[model samples]
Target: MTMKRYPIAIALAVAGSFAGCWTGGVIQLFSCDDPCYGLDPYECDDPCATCEGECLPPPLLGYDDPILLWTGEAAEEAAVPECPPEAPGLVFDGYGGFEADHVCPECRCTEPSCELPGGLTGSASAACDGTTPTSFDAPAGWSGACTAPAAVGSGELGSLLIQAPTVSGCAPANDAGAAPPELPAPWTVRARGCSGEAGVHTCREPGKMCVAAPVPRPTGFAMCVRYLRPGAPECPAEYPELREIYREFDDTRSCTPCGCGPLEGSACTALVSAYEDEGCSALLGAETVTLAGPKCVAGPELRIESMEARWIKDEPGTCAATGGVAVGEATPKGATFFCCQSDEVIAVP
Candidate 1:
């Protein structure tokens, strides 16, 4: 009974257990055998782990993009750039910038400066205050009268005051024996009778005259002409043809017909050309005439001479034989006719 024996495998397990207990319960069979002791002790099995000193305390956080570590200790901050102070007489353009001078009313911004619009300039009577001047020069070609001196100041910076000029005085006269200065277009000269010993000439109002007459005197002559105005007839007796046309066409007293002048001093040839241009096919029988007359005319022997003439095809039939005294033949009841010749229309014999 004392000769009992264990298996060889059981005997080896008992010996291994004793060795494990001696090494703090670590089994030597699969235990890590690191030559670098205590260096990353937990990383003993990691292939990339090295025994190079202590693990460097994990790179101290944010090593790539370093920032100031605000510890309990105090330190000075980094310096920053300063901006320039604002200047006087300048206003911000609302976008991180400033503009020179104050903006003016109705002002337009031009490069390097601002501009005011052009307008009528004249002097007006106004009392001058302390800041405003009593008098100033009016704009060119303009005149005005002010009881007191007045100044118009600009809204912009360093703007100057403007003064008005007087416009009521008589214009100066020209030199003796010299031709008078020509008036502006549509403004002719007229004689305002005689002023004392000297003859006086003045410009007539624009659009007032229908005909321009020659200057009567050499020095003090002003242009005076007839204008096409209604009421009292100013038709010159020299142009009897125009008067006759006016009588026939101007029943309503409208001045329109008078404009078709045997215009003073114009030739008959020019008048005929003017009438043709005005869509008149014939000149009728007048030295000077207008298109404002009856359209149709009946005659014993009618001849259509104008290139604008066409046969009256009432019902689409050939015109009657070219020449002869035909009664009621070529006459179209409500149609207009014009005398074909350049001369005046003569009464049938």
Candidate 2:
């Protein structure tokens, strides 16, 4: 059988396949006849099939520089670090964990208002039962001063009609810019300093090499990962193991509900009197009534020529307030990952 010859490049690759020591920056092949048996088939006419001692592992892949990271509050701004030559600098990756404080303003109500009694009438029917009625109403906005509205014969005024005051204008008070501002931005961080070397190396087959590893990992870093897509994805062949996660986020924080209560505690009253003369000189009878209006009462048996009404008591009311609190949370967005390579450290000779 005719033997086939392989090229020098192929021979060198095959010769470097077996175990050998790392010197300076290159792999030094040993002759097959040597006790260590480096498996160089071309070194000796007859190649040794086996080695007497354990073989050295190949070199490992490591990043030329360390991966950088920076993080802070969503509202705070942070500065990024410069990268090594020929490598990408710190970039805005995404957001990670988050924190927030949300709140609402207090609520309140304005004071209640009221108007005194107006428009009084008289009836010849006893008990003011709306029979043979006559207009004895005081002028609009009339005070307690004496005035003759109408004259009545002896024993003609049997009853009187008085309408209660008007109550109104109770509303919720305004807050000092109680509404909240717009939502804040998501948490952020800068990372990924540089990458490891690429392409085939001269390291021994099945042997790991030692190179410089980034000193201490960045603070709060889940782990070192190679990024391929915007989201978590399969790691490169160099870094096979990995964990998926996000670097940025979407904020949903907000405030609770708030409002005011019903108005209450308001009241009003007035005193009314009938006089025997138009000048209101001789007092015939008098009574006090509330603003529930159209109140009727029996008149004095004597004749009434005039009448008078004076506001006696008026009480203002207030409303209670409710609900003003903080609530809600934020969600994570923009995915990424953590990946790694070999951890072996080989001593250089």
Candidate 3:
């Protein structure tokens, strides 16, 4: 399924430099510390991807041919300091410089990206570590044999997983000569809203899955898992009918790995010969945010969550005038973009 993200962390006033920015950063590995991400030349297509998870990137920033970086650290790829929906982000002035906020609160990441009738766990992020899932869904049919050789020393570390299908409604036909029905089978990523039907799976990541609790649904809203009969197609035609086109399902694509290259040791392997600007006044220490922002910022009826900006003066207000903001002061207020609380995150001057 094609998913477009709306980076909620992007403020559009400053550039960001950090790990979560999709432009170029770390890769989300499994839930293991000291993860050694393997990059093979021709392993699987793409694995360990987090399309809709904690590292949801803000709309203000994005990735360009992003390569996943690996570390054997048991880090929280899905955890942000304070935001509810912990996602990677960028602080960009849109003039060639940036900062990594690690939180995208403004962008819309809904699958098919049409604002589903739920929370923001369904958003997207560009800065997902290997531990943080980049993309996952039920394999088309588990029809392929993946007994390929381990790519160790071969230059690429790939990822592959196998799970039993979760069927509900119909009892899989095991009769002597029973014919399997031609319907879609049950399968999906471990996301929350995904397992609405017997044949579907769901995500559990904080800001990337179902809300803390399921809300009351209107009349025809669907929510039970359907057990697909054996011998069914992957996805049937005339499905979703525009609302949630089956293609938009969280686990639409299988968790396959894409060969990148041999893994990097620690810190940085290759080094630069000389320095251009000994000191360019670049930022080093990163700013911290709340862990509950994502939870408070999602849903059709959101809130007036935050406000911060840089390079602006009065009328715009800074931390000095606002409170403990910690960003954007020595400029004109009109020269900045601020994030305001509303039904959904709204951008203000």
Please report, in order, the local distance difference test score of every candidate based on alpha carbons.
0.19, 0.51, 0.19
- Cα lDDT of candidate 2 equals 0.51
Task: Return the TM-score for each candidate structure.
Answer: 0.11, 0.40, 0.12
- Tens digits of per-residue lDDT for model 3 on 1-349? 1112226454434333322224224232221121122533222222223223212112122111111111111123242121112212211111101221221112111111011011111112222122542122212332222211111221121221111112112211122133222222222111111211110112323222221111222222222112133332232121211111121212121111111222122111111011112231222111211211211111221111111111111121111111111222111111111111111221110
TM-score between candidate 1 and the true structure: 0.11
Alpha-carbon RMSD, candidate 2: 13.5
Best by TM-score: 2
How many angstroms is residue 221 displaced in model 3 relative to the true structure, after the best TM-score fit?
27
Q: Give the C-alpha miss distance for residue 314 in model 3, angstroms.
A: 46
How many pairs of residues collide in each model? 20, 16, 101
Q: How would you encode candidate 1's per-residue C-alpha lDDT over 247-310 as one tens digit per residue? A: 1111111111101111122111101111112233443221211222211212222221111111
lDDT of 2 at 348: 31
Best by lDDT: 2
lDDT of 2 at 303: 71
Q: After superposition, how far is residue 219 of candidate 2 from its true place, in Å?
A: 20
The full ranking of all candidates by lDDT, starting with the best, is: 2, 3, 1
Once fitted onto the true fold, the runs of candidate 2 whose alpha carbons sit more than 4 angstroms away are: 1-101, 121-124, 131-158, 174-259, 262-267, 272-286, 291-294, 300-311, 325-349
